[model samples]
Target: MSKVFLSAKLPAATTKILTDHGLTVSVYAGEGLISHAELLKSVVDVDYLITPLSTQVDAAVIDAAPKLKLIANFGAGFNNIDAAYAKTKGIQVTNTPAVSTNSVAEVTVGLMLALSHRIVEGDAQMRTSGFPGWAPLYFLGSEIAGKTLGIVGFGNIGREVARKARALAVNVQYWQPHRLTDPEERSLGVQYVEFADLVQTSDFISINAPQKPDNHHQFSAAVFKEMKATAFLINVGRGPIVDEAALLTALQQGVIGGAALDVYEHEPQVTAGLEKLNNVILTPHIGNATVEARAAMGTIVANNVVLLEQGHNAKFIVNA
Candidate 1:
């Protein structure tokens, strides 16, 4: 039986599958995130490593695990893992993609609605008894109907968001490196525009792009300035894609209306300035945290490890 190091606690279903397969699963059993030193100690002499996006499985950590054959990530984003280095060591890397797409897309849309309608502000006012009386023009907000929704990256999750927005009667536009054909665009009810045009024309921008070298700091002060003053931004994708400092300035200077972020640039340690803004809706990177989504992701991770150990192809191999 192969030895598996479960860096983060997984669902009971995942644990059963690994144990049923006769793999010796060693869990950290810690209350919070496992530290680098702890992870190094846990992964030593382990045949497989199952971890989350928060875990940093870098070269140093990998070097400590001489027996590691596979690194199974709990989510779609493997930005936390060093894929190139893992490949060099003849170690397979896998991510659980497609499992949490709809759940995350739904959260992105929910954030957009909350920001557009000022739901958080209304709740705060009601809680503090600030709503003395209702007026005809009280708590004015923009409607989602007939508004242009520009998606930065049109991947599976982005496409799912578009479909949901269309059901709400929204005009969808997308910008990616590769342009879709006219027929494909018609089917998705989206048009591919240049990055600058998407920023300038979109009434609401939802970022669903991956975090890559070219996309780092993609939304800077210049990009924010290009947007319409009434436009809102929503990010359900990776953090560092948007410059937090630039986003703060945009909200402060009224360059853009507001933003709803599920992920942040620094993550877990959001900038102090952003916390002061009531116009922004922030979540601690819980986009794909639904019970169903987490279970599905965990199952995928477990199956990937099993497949790799059995010398079969995993469902979503990052190195491939």
Candidate 2:
């Protein structure tokens, strides 16, 4: 039997799918992401490894696992892996894409609505001081209808967000490395604009782009300065793409209206004073945390392992 090591716990059904095929699976038994030491120990003698976004499958891991043939990521993005290095070592990498599209898009729109309407703050006020009454001027929340939403990436999640945002009567414009054709734009009801124009004119700015060297910290102090004071910033992607310090300064100085983040620049650690602010909403990276999405991701990971074992092409290989 081939030895498979799962870096962290997966849905039991997902584990069952692998076990049913007679693969010997070694799983991390504790809570949360497995520690670096544990991951190093676990990879020493495995045939395949499954990882979550929080776990980094670097060169060290590859070197440790001389028998490893596959690294299956449980998320859409494989940025956590050292793909180039893995390819040189003859280890294939794969990720479960599109499975979290609707899950993330739902959270994106929810954050937009929650931030715009002061939902979290309102809930806090109600629980602590109690609402005096339904006063019109008490908690003046902005209406999302008839507003412009600028998406930074026009990928699966971005398109899904656009579709849902349109249902709420929001005009969607996007800026990506590539532009969509007239027909595609018409089909998705989105307009392609330059990054500058999207930032300057949007009523809300949503970051959906992946983190890259050139684009890392792309939403820094300089970019925040160009946004409307009333425009909210929404991030449902990688945290490092936005400079947390710049974002903190922007919110404190009113450079932008407000912000909501599902992912932080520092994973599991939010910047100081961000949580204290009434204008910002923070989530613990639950973009694709739905039960359905996770189960599907687990299945994909297991299937990738099975496909490789059978000498067939995996479904979503990142570094072919």
Residue 122 in model 1: shift from native, Å? 0.9
lDDT of 2 by residue, 1-320 (tens): 89999888889988898899899998999877798888999999899999998899889889989999999999998888999999999999999999999999999999999999999999999999998898767899988999999999889999999999999999999999999889999999999999999999999989988878878899999999999999999999889999999999999999999999999888888999999899999999999999999999999999989888989988899898
**TM-score for all predictions?**
0.98, 0.98
**Model 1: worst 10 consecutive residues (lDDT sum):** 267-276
lDDT of each: 0.91, 0.93
- What global local distance difference test value does model 2 have? 0.93
Pull out the clashing pairs in model 2: none
Tens-digit lDDT track of model 1 for 1-320: 79998888889999999999999998989888999999988888899999999999999999999999999999899999999999999988999989889998899889878988999988988898688787989899888999999999999999999999999999999999999889989998888899999999999999998899999999999999899999999988888999999999999999999999889888867877887898998888888999999999989989988898788988888986
